[model samples]
Structure formats: structure tokens, C-alpha cells
Target: MNTTTLASTTRLNPVSRPLPVLLAMEDDAEDVGRLSPDDRLTCHVHGRWIHQCVASPLHVNPITRHRWCRSCATALTVSVDELSGAVTMSCPRCGHGASAASARLIVACRASLVAARRGSGARAA
Candidate 1:
């Protein structure tokens, strides 16, 4: 998308100004692979909540094992509570998907949940 499209979408209401960092991330250098999942949650991209997109194939990392279950050879399942904003990442096969990356992601997801619910200025398009 061009600058024009991005400019239009970041507008939450007529009187509001766009936040410096919460704008669209579609042009974010292709999926923001290097960006932390938590930071990805704070930005408006894909028009979905953090929990909605956290389990995407893009998040799977076999080498670093960010969300990988080495023994099961599968990506971990993500569960998030909407009201309570609880995030869970467990292997679907053996329930052994725990890692430093997943822990960081969980924290980010919870914070994102809070922001999504409380911040009127950071709505996704």
C-alpha cells in the first residue's frame, strides 16, 4: 500500500491524530519477521487482534524453536482468554511447548489485549 492508503486507515475518529507507532504494518518489510511478536501486537496490521494472529505459520521457528515442539515436530497451540487476557502456548501433541520466546510472547499478548480494550486511539483498520 502507498502512503495515502496508510494515512487514511490510521484515523480512528475525525478529531484524533494518528499515533506515531500504531499505524499499519502491511508495509512492514514483509510480515515483520524480525520484530518481536509483542511489538507486532501493538501495531495495527492484518486488522486483527494479537491472539487472532499469533499462531500463524510465520511465527513458527524450527531452528530457534520459538514456538516449535521439537519432540512432537509441531507448532504449539495458542489459547487466549478474551475477558481475562490470558495467553497460553502448549504443544497440541504432548503439551511440552514452553520456551523463552513463548513466555515473552505471552506477556506481549496480554499487554496487547489490555491496549486493544482500553485504547480508543489504536484501533486496527
Candidate 2:
């Protein structure tokens, strides 16, 4: 997507910004991997409250593993840099940082997950 289109598709609605940097510092980079079942919930959390993307309602958050949106599946792949411990959500279809909003979303979602797991009480199952 072009910058304008991407901007419209993904706005700057970052609910959690600084937390991602903190997570990068605290967690090992190798700890992050392909999205797992828990990571599915992370996407859900981001879709509903953070990004408000329309495609989110159609997403399937199954218990068996992590899921990606059609767009995310097609254009992006999320990974963690082992040396820095930073969760890097990159778009293979595009170039590095091609999707800044997506990168921010990943960071925000991961941060929120860490907070929720650490007793932030943002949501509960």
C-alpha cells in the first residue's frame, strides 16, 4: 500500500508505545517466535481496542495457534531480533519498515500482553 493508503488503513492510534521498548529490554529476543495461541489473543486485543481495523472482526483466534489477518499474512512476517530482544514485525512483501503502523501495532500488542500478564488487568479470560 502507498503511504496515503497505508496511513488511512492504519492510523496512529498507539495505546501503548513505551512498553514495547521496555519489553525489548526485559525479554529475550529469541523468546518471540511465530505467533502462538497466546499471540492470537494479542491480535484480538490490538484489533478491537488499538487499531479498530475492520478486517479484525473476520479474524479467527483459535486456541491451537496464532493467526494473521489476510493482509498481514500476505504482506508481513513478525520476528524477534535475538541480539537486541526487540520484537520486529517486518513486511516481507514490502521493504523494511514498510508498514510502520503494523510495526507499532505489534509492539503495542506485545507490550499490552506483557502488561496484562503482569497483572495489569486490562482484560481477563
Candidate 3:
């Protein structure tokens, strides 16, 4: 990865969740804002579903350009800027960058994002 891409890629902690689940969980209904108690529960359930979906391995083939995680069945699109050493993954819902090894860290960040959204949403609602 180029320095710029590397810089853009968020560094994850040593232990963290997977990215998609984190993202989905972060944006759960309650976090999005103005949800009722039932909506909050529904959102939590949805997030749990997403978490299960992200807890598996992804498959990739260099020759076929076929890459996807078995759990979520989401397509994997990667962008590498040769000049800048930036490697980004356009996740199903959002785009974030980091070295492959940083995947765990990215996931952790997403969890935090979910917490942030929930906090803000609670205040807004």
C-alpha cells in the first residue's frame, strides 16, 4: 500500500470484530434515530444477525476476480492506488481503507461508530 492509502486506512486494534457486522450494528435502527423501544429491539436483533453474517471466511480467486465473504455474501471490491499505496475496500455499505492485516482494527472502529450513532440518536430522539 502507498503511504497515502496506508495513512487513510484506519488502524485496528489487536482484537476486533469484522467490518460489515460492525457497520450494520453501528447503524442499527436505534442508532439511526427516533426509534421506539420495539424499534430498538428490532435493530439490536438485526445487528445480531449481521454479526453472525460477518463471522466467517471470505473466498477470493485472483484469476476470476471473484471475491466475497461466505457469511454475508457481499461482493468484495478492492481499490489499490499504485502511486499512493492506498488500498481500500468498498464494503457493501461504506468504503474504508487499511492494510489487509488491519481488518480487525477496522471492525473495531465500526463498532465504535455504532456506539456513537446510538448515543447521538438517543439524544436526538
Candidate 4:
């Protein structure tokens, strides 16, 4: 019987090992704005997209016209239905509409969602 250590096994099949691919930082300004809405690659505000900046969920306040959920008094999560292209913001706890300022945000979110679905199909091909 023979026993091989985990480290030894890794060394024997280096080519079979999966390599971690890091996303390169985008530098071209022209390409940055060209990103589709659903493209999480770059943020509209920041020149480069940082996960923390773009990934954080949004909230909305009807009275204040700000990002806040007054019914639940907490931040709201934005949900996108990829199939129907419907973007909605609601109180996570109470299921109430949080803000009237959602019109612009909703439009942007819908466009992004649709773009993402289309992009995925292209990549698969």
C-alpha cells in the first residue's frame, strides 16, 4: 500500500489545477461609460466599479425622495425580474412601496437587467 500526501498530489498535477483569474482594473474611460446598465463591471458614479460601491442594495424614502424605506424604517433591497424586466423597490419587512422616486431607478434597473440577460446569451455562444 502507498500513501501520498496532499501537497505531493498537488505538485504532481500542476496543470490539472485550476488557476484563479483576477479581473483586471479597467483604465479606458471611453469603454467605461459604454458599459450596459446591468453590467456590474463598472459603476456609473465611480470611474472604476468597486464591489462595495455597486453591490450595496438601494433604499428609498417617498417623502424625502431619498434612498430610504420608511415603512420598515430600514434599507430596501432592489429586485429585478430578469424575465419580465420589472424592477421594484419595497420594504423588505412590510412589502410596502417605499418611495415615489423609484421611477428613474426602476428604469435604470430594468435596462440593466435586460442587458445582462442578453450579454449572458452572447457569452455562452
* Best model number under lDDT: 1
Model 3: lDDT equals 0.35
The local lDDT score (0 to 100) that residue 67 gets in candidate 1 is 77
Per-model TM-score, in order, reads 0.62, 0.31, 0.22, 0.42
How many collisions between residues are there in candidate 1?
Answer: 0
* Model 4 spans with C-alpha error above 4 angstroms: 1-42, 45-55, 58-67, 117-125
Candidate number with the higher lDDT (1 or 2): 1
**Residues 25-114, candidate 3, lDDT per residue (tens digit)?**
435533444322211211233343222222223423223333343344455555433334343444464343223433432343344344
The model with the greater TM-score, 3 or 4, is: 4
What is the Cα-based TM-score of model 2?
0.31
Candidate 1 lDDT: 0.60
For each candidate in turn, give its C-alpha RMSD to the true structure in angstroms.
8.0, 14.3, 15.1, 17.2
- lDDT of each residue in 1-125, candidate 4, tens digit only: 23432223323443221111101212232244432233223344543222223225433344564445675566656665556766666657777644555544554455444434444555566
Ten contiguous residues minimizing lDDT sum, candidate 2: 1-10
Q: What does the lDDT read for residue 92 in candidate 3?
A: 60
lDDT of each: 0.60, 0.35, 0.35, 0.42
| Comparing 1 and 4 on lDDT, the stronger one | 1
Q: What is the lDDT for 11 in model 3?
A: 28
Ranking 2 against 3 by TM-score, winner: 2
Alpha carbon RMSD to native, model 1: 8.0
Q: How far in Å is the alpha carbon of 4 misplaced in model 4?
A: 67
